[model samples]
Target chain A: MSYKDKKVITIGVVRDLTGLSERQIRYYEERKLIFPERTPGGSRKYSFADVELLVEIANKIEDGVQTHEIRKEMLRAQKKQNQEDVRRKMIQGQLNAQFGLRKGPTS
Target chain B: MSYKDKKVITIGVVRDLTGLSERQIRYYEERKLIFPERTPGGSRKYSFADVELLVEIANKIEDGVQTHEIRKEMLRAQKKQNQEDVRRKMIQGQLNAQFGLRKGPTS
Candidate 1:
């Protein structure tokens, strides 16, 4: 999921879900590793992808990867995901053409 | 220069050059905006480009941009730089063909 969805979620909840401490979560925010939304009151809120990223970052740190390396890895991961999406879309288009359906696949 | 080129300078030199504190420099390193190399003794060394990037990062931060946003901006900047390089090469190829120099422009 993208960062736009999942409004009304707070950092405390994210900490609980990701098992990352509040400080580390804030640290990640400060590092720009994750861009969580801040409320009118300045409380941090995380999206689903943000939580996933924090967990991923935690695992990467445990694997001896630094934050900048993790950022690079994430960029690579996002590029791969985009390529996969394009590949899937092409396959779906081919399938639709074979079936003679103007509408796209429901799935 | 890329992150691999410079390999003997220390964080102190970067601090002096950028006017960024040692902790903040280390913090940025931890955040991974710039990747400097380390010596065999584990000292951080800044490349010319790395130093430029640190100065850029300082400007971005002062302008109230977060690290993740800055990261995205940097990716865009790199992509733009790559496009400019490609455009330059294409022009150079055209010039070489017009000059009957398959070896390319002397300058």
Candidate 2:
């Protein structure tokens, strides 16, 4: 359920999994949409998260969403995720403080 | 503090924060160690996580570790993190089941 393995899944596997072409994946990279890591031998490698992202991008493009618009949407989503993370940490900190946990955020 | 902002910070800011040269950062990217996202216009953008990774890579290189070794270590660390995520999820699932939560992983 997690795609935390960075630079392990090949582009070919991503292509197979997402039903996307190599060219389309590379184009997404060029559009600054997905950031796949390269192998030491210079082959592009993707993670499952990248594959999911590609499918989402492909879906949006099919719905007539521009690549630039997708990029903006990604930024907004990233910002929202960041805010949620902060909020979670703050809640955790407050809970810790309320429980008199010595290792609370402020401590 | 979490560094979850992807592709928001610039390479210059990364360089300033990590005390690493641009060439060194690019070299790490070339070595397939760090994966920075590119801007739409093609400038490299880094997140705070990338900056921290660069600093760690720099320290390792200073300690005479090869880039390939660093890459292997990264893969190992990533695998460990993935396992941890799975373990956490399993624990969450068990807790949810115990609490009669309807939205457990299996449910």
Clashing pairs in 2: none
The prediction achieving the highest TM-score against the true structure is 2
**TM-score (C-alpha) between model 2 and the true structure:** 0.46
* Tens digit of per-residue lDDT, candidate 1, span A2-103: 323443345655665688899999987777688876655576755556767789899989999888888887789889999999999999888878985566
Q: Write the per-residue lDDT of candidate 2 for residues B25-80, one digit (tens) a residue.
A: 99999999988876556778676578778889999999999999999999999999
**Candidate 1 deviant stretches above 4 angstroms:** A1-107, B1-8, B102-107
TM-score of model 1 relative to the true fold?
0.42
**DockQ for each model:** 0.01, 0.03
Q: For candidate 2, lDDT tens digit of each residue in A1-107? A: 33244444556556766898999999999999999876556777666567778999999999999999999999999999999999999998898779855754863
- Put down candidate 1 lDDT per residue, B1-107, tens digits, no spaces: 33224332356555655788999888888886878766545667565466678888989899999988988888899899999999999998898788855565767
